[model samples]
Structures are given as structure tokens and as C-alpha cells.
Target: MSMTPPPGWYRDPSYPLVERWWDGTAWTDHRRQPEAPQLPLTQPESPGGGGSGRAKAVALSVAGVVLVASIVTGAVLLRRDDGSGDAAATTTETTTETTTATTAVSPSASDTPSPSASTSAPSPDDPSVVVDELNGITLPLLDGWVRPQYVAEHDIVMTTPGTYDCPGDPGLCRHGRVISRTVTANDEKSPKALAQQDIEDAANSSYDRDLIDNRPFKGITSHQEVKSGQVAVAGRAGYFVRWKVKTRVGPGGYVESLAFPSSVGSESLVIVRFAFDAGSDGPPLTDMDRITKGIRPVGDADTGGGVGSSIGPSK
Candidate 1:
């Protein structure tokens, strides 16, 4: 005769100390729960008749993830910006034909445009001024200085004879070369008047326009003024009228400039510009004074019909 278990008790008397009884369909109720816990109900190996092969696949996936993470970590260390020097250095022997000259002004002075008494000008549309005549360009303005060498390049507008280098280097491989082009009084309006307008116009006229409008040209960060001739270089007294304008250049790439032309001459306008990137290296203005003061125009002026020497312009 089979003995039926008690209503709440299904005793496994194999090692009977206290019995684990059934609570309805399962052994949930116990006289005293054991300290050495039993294996859980959800620990079934595989319901679909499989080994731990499924677990092995998951392990392999985790391993693959760790391997990929390792590879990325190695590459990142090699490509970091910390002390990588710029990409511009390695490929071209650190020499560029269109390098810029950069430096600073002295404590006794600054590159800043100082307040000065204004110089009055003739009317913009005065009949006495003939616009197009190459001869229309004032002559006496460059009387003492030599002729500026005209080179048809984008980075150069009109440079007196001198050497130009990039931001920090002593002298970029190119030496004894200067570039310039014909400037019109039509754009300038006042053929005789030497002002920042003529300098800005010269900057925006040719390939250098993209160099400037697209960038500070020197990579400066924060600016307080525009580029006017305030910072006077030795043997060349001048100022850099600073213009902090919002240009179409990329973000934080504003423009700053300073120019110094001989007081009265054909090559009387020298312009210096800086294009600043907020996140990059500091600007090249630290050694700019030596480079700018180094600019020297060669040859006498091609003054037109005695109009420039005696008076400013024909008009």
C-alpha cells in the first residue's frame, strides 16, 4: 500500500534533519531552511536540448569587443595633438614660398593704432582726379625709395625688397624676393591720400584677398582692434590700425592687421594681417617688428607730369 504524503509535507527522508514541505505545488515551506543553499530553479542548462555552446558564443562576442577596444586605444596614442608639431613641417622641408614674417613691438611702443589728428582729403568724385591713368597714380609718393618688384603671386600684393619667413623660423628658404602689382586710384579714389582704405583695398584685391578674408593670415586668437599703422618699425615709423571685423572666415578666425608705408612715396602702403584660430598655437606677432621694418622698396618714383611732386594729384 502506498503511503500518501502529508497535506503540506513532501519529505525527502534521505538525510532527514528537518523536512522541506510543499506549499501547494512546490517545496516553498520548510521547518528550518538550510544554511548551505540549494541550486536555483532557473539554473536549467538549456531548455532546447543544447549544451553551454550558447554561453560560449556570448563569451566570444565579449572577447571580440575587447579586442577592438584595444586596437583603437593604440592608434589614439600615436595620433594625439600633444607635441605632434604641425603637419606643415615634415612634408615641405619646413620651407614655403608664401611664408609670413611675424613678431612683436617693444615696451616703449605697441602695434596698436594710436589716436592721431585726422588728415583732410579731396572729394571722392572730384573732376580734377583722372581715375584710370597709370600716370594717374601719384608719383612723388615713392620718390626717394626704389621701385617695388612686381611678382604675380597670390600671397604678395606689393612688397619692398626683403626676406619673408613663416611664423617662428628665421628665414623661409626664399630670400631677396618681393612681390607687388598695379593699384588703381579708382578703387582708392584719392590718388594722393594715404590711408587705411587703400591698404584694405590692396589686401582684398587679389589672391591675398582669399588669404585674408578666409583667414587672419597669421592665426591670431582674441583681437581688440583693426590693422592700422600704429606699430612703427625702426628705420620705418608706422602704425597698425587694428580692425576687429566679423568676416566670412571660419569660426573664431577673425582678422587683425598693421601697415607701414614710407610717409610719401609710390610704395607708401605696407599691410600686415593675422588670421587667428582660437584652438591652435599662439600668434606669430612676437617677432613681427624685424620683418616689417626689413621691407625696403627699390628705385625712384615714376611720378606723372610733375603733378604728384608739386601737388598731391592732378585733381
Candidate 2:
């Protein structure tokens, strides 16, 4: 039986000029020319039949140079045969280090973004004034009007001094009282219905009766009259009426009511009342027109015209 040499570089059986690598039991593709062995140090023969020290030193130097050259060539062959394995391993280690660093810096699940620092400005359509602490409705601030006060039940009042507060010289009363009220509407409400309600409400008011009963002169007769029509108040088409009561003291300052009927949840009536002395220096009818036109629901901009601007509800 023939025994095989251990796995290593050996002279090729087929090619005489190169050696091939044997892996344990099999021949591998790796092949290279065998590295030449370095010459052994051989001293020169002197006349005495033995080399002198100088000659031995020179031979040893030459042998050392050849040995270094052989070692360099063998190292090159070893590295060439190793192929891309080393570079691939180095690249894999570098990739692993980069991956570890990235994972360490990544944000965790508990991280949260910081909140913004600035406050926002007010919106143009937002309401500046709120009315009725209970049944709150909001609107923009009205020019030329004082702060509103919740006075009577279901009523919020605001007024211009020159109108509601006549210049003291007037013997009777003043006007320009802009009163707002939210009232429940009857099922058959229309522009005419608003006018009728205004007439009834004014005729029953104590203020109207007192003005009629307390006559500055005894001969004057007192009577209640309501003049109503479809007037556009605050760009809204609704029933507007002027309630006038003539007394001995002259025509009692008229009570003007402008009704804006629209649905808000289940409630459907928004009434604005204007009371001013007809004889005293009071607010003009135009002022009443402006107030009604400017009115808008909370957070809603004026949509060109107000409630029922084109036509009244179909009767």
C-alpha cells in the first residue's frame, strides 16, 4: 500500500514546473512554482585546507541574503493563495462596527418631540363679545356701543350714550337703547309674525302705559300704533316695526324692534330692540340699520346678507 503525504503544497503529478495544494484528502486548484531553496553557507578552501574567518564571513553574508529573498517570495505566494478571504473578513468587521454605532445612536420608543413655543393670533371671524351668560351667543364688538349688561330676563342690553342717555335737557326720556333677546318662536313665525309680536309686547309693557298715563297735560289722548314693513337690518331681511304711543307729554320715544329669525339648535328667534326719544337728540334710524346689519352669529362671518335676506320663509 502507498501512503499519501499530509495536506500541503507538493510537486504536481501532472505539471513538473509547479506545485499544487492538497486539502486533507483531495487535490485543490491552488498552484504555484515551488520556491527555490537557499544555498547553504559554504566556506572557501584556503591553502591550509580550511576557510579563513574572513572567507567564512563573506559566504555567510551571501547565504543570509538568499535566505531573505526566498522567504519574501514564499510570503508572496502564501498571500496570493489566501485570495479575497482576508479582505472580505476585514470588510465584514467594519460593517459590523458601523451597524453597532448606528444602533446605539438611534432614538428609543420613549422619545417625544418638543412642543411649539409660539402662540397664534386671533382669527378675524372669531367673536370678540359674548352675550347671555346662560344661553350664550357671541358676536363681534359693536362700535359706538357701551359694554353690554344682562338686565332683564332673556335680555342683554347695550347703548350709545348720546341715544339712550339724552343730554339731560329732555323732559321725558332718551333713546338709542340696543337690546338683544333670544326668544322661543311660535311654529307659524314669519316676517308678519315678528311684527305682530313686537306690537303686542310693546303695548303690554309698563313703560308704554306709564308714559301714556302720566300726562304733562290733561287734555292729551294716549294711543298705541305700530308701523311695520320688511326692512333690511344689518344686511338681513326681516320684519322691522316702529311702536309709537302718543301721550300728553308728546309722542313717546318710539320702540323699534328688528327681528332676525334663524335656527340655532331648537331656538329660532333673535330680536334686537331700539328705544330712543323721537323728540330728543337721539340715534338716527340709520344707526339702527347699521347695528342690525352688523350682527352675526358666534364664529360665523357675515355671509354677504343676513338671515332671510333674499326672501321671507314661504308662507
Candidate 3:
């Protein structure tokens, strides 16, 4: 802020006089000082030309002090941010002084975290659970079971595996799985259709007795529609029914009747019927009581009955 003008000219003090210029550092363009009227060491020119006595020196002194103070303040600010602070930090908007002052901390590789652990599935105690709506009960079914085959849709037929010629009369079997098994006629589709088809499928395929409708396949024994209702899977709607009962297969005997309502629901009233052919291995009474155990329907129906269809005969 000092305003010392470059040596140029100074107002001369003589009457009607003008100015004197300077060279390098000495007064130049000098007029000889009147030896008689000596030039005062320095003259305060009257209002017309000379400058002030002490004012100029004071101004220059103040400017020098201000410049020195600025330099010192800048240095301290920089040092404080650099690493002089307990927890020094710096950001983009920070003053340049602060940036020059601090440094970011970095950790060794060992200090970094290891990879995260992988997740696992539930154990037996945890019990993998799946909810299914059967009857009015929304319950869980066993998680894993070996299912030979299953389809969103299919037909059921019943027949006992019985053979005409064999050491043990290797029983014939109901051909439960087949296109011919596709549910057709309402008469052809009830639980009876299942029973009949089983016997037929078994006889036709294995026993060489195709379409043996001689004796109506032992009628499917239905207890009472234990529970029946409309159900849907992915929007496919059908009626579901469950029941248990006993029925006679041939002229001599009867077998246990379990309500095997696998097709609880379908497009129509799903009538689940389980019946064993009287002639099956066990005693007549035991045959009828077998329903207590799982009926084990092979095809559409358990072939223990004497039904037969193109699918196969029930075993």
C-alpha cells in the first residue's frame, strides 16, 4: 500500500519558479542553491507545491508492518491444517492454506476386512416349510419325498397288478400313465372311471385282456364326501372331494375303502374313491381294513380293484 512515487519532479521553492527532477537516486536538473539565501535542508512548500513533513514517512512505515504480519499469519494457518491438528481433515472447498496443512490417513492391507461369509439353508430343526391349502386347513406337507411322477394335471385309474401265468402269478398292473387315460366322458371320468380304467389298462396291456368290461370294475367305495370345495392352482379351478368306505370287488369278498382324494379339485367335482378288489391277496376282512394304511394309488386309482382300461389293469 505504500505510494512512494518514482523519483520524477518536486515543486521548486523560488518565486514564480516551477520544478526540479531527479536522477537515479540523487537530485538532478539542479539549480544551484542561492548561496546567499541558503535552501533549508527541506522546505515545506507553501500550499502551492511542497509536501508534508512527517505524513509520508508514517504511511510508509505502516505499509511495511502490514506486509510482514500477512506473511506470518499465512504460514501459521498452513501448518495448523497440515498435520499439526489432532484430527486434521481437508475437503475440496477448504482454503488452499488448509489443504497444504493436512494429510489423509491410510491403513495397511491387513487392516482391511476379509470377504463376507456365505449364507446357508435351514436345517431339520429349522424345518424347511411350505404351506398348502388342503380342506379348510392350510398346512405343511413333508418337504422331500421321492415322487415317481407328477403333473399339474393328470387322470387316475385303478387296478391290481395281477398276472395270468407266473411263479407267483406276477400280477398285472394298471397303466395309469397314458394319453388314453385322459379323462373323457362324465361317465368315463368319475372316481369309477378311475377304477374301471385301472383294471382295463392293466388287463389290456399286461394280461392280454384289453377292454375286459365283463364285470364292472369293483365300484369305487366312497365314504362320505369328507370335504369338498373349489380350489385353484395358478388359476386352474376344480372341485375337490375326500371320503372313505369299503366295497366288494368280486362275488366272494370285499376290501377296505380309503378315500384317496389326490385330485381334491379339478374342473369338475373331484370325487376321490379307494376300493380294493375282493380277490386281492389278503383276507376279505383285512382287505377292507387296508384303507387305514396309505391306499398307495398307482395310477388314477389303486389297482387293487378289478378295473381295467387302455391305461392298464389295476394290480
TM-scores for candidates 1 onward, in order: 0.27, 0.44, 0.19
Q: Give the higher-lDDT candidate: 2 or 3.
A: 2
Instruction: Write candidate 2's Cα lDDT for 258-281 as tens digits.
Output: 665543455455566666445545
- After superposing candidate 2 on the true structure, give the runs of residues whose Cα lies further than 4 Å from its correct spot: 1-143, 149-154, 162-174, 185-188, 203-227, 231-237, 304-309, 312-314
- Candidate 2 yields a Cα-based lDDT of 0.39
lDDT of each: 0.27, 0.39, 0.23
* Candidate with the greatest lDDT versus the true structure: 2
lDDT of 1 by residue, 40-144 (tens): 222123445452432222222211011232233234323322222112321111111332221210111222222111111223553222111211122111211
Off by over 4 Å in 1: 1-195, 198-229, 245-249, 254-257, 262-278, 281-283, 293-315
Collision count of model 1: 48
In each prediction, how many residue pairs overlap at the backbone (N, C-alpha, C within less than 3 A)? 48, 4, 46
Off by over 4 Å in 3: 1-210, 214-222, 249-315
Lowest lDDT sum, 10 consecutive residues, model 3, at 92-101
Poorest stretch of ten by lDDT in candidate 2: 91-100
Error of 1 at 172 (Å): 21
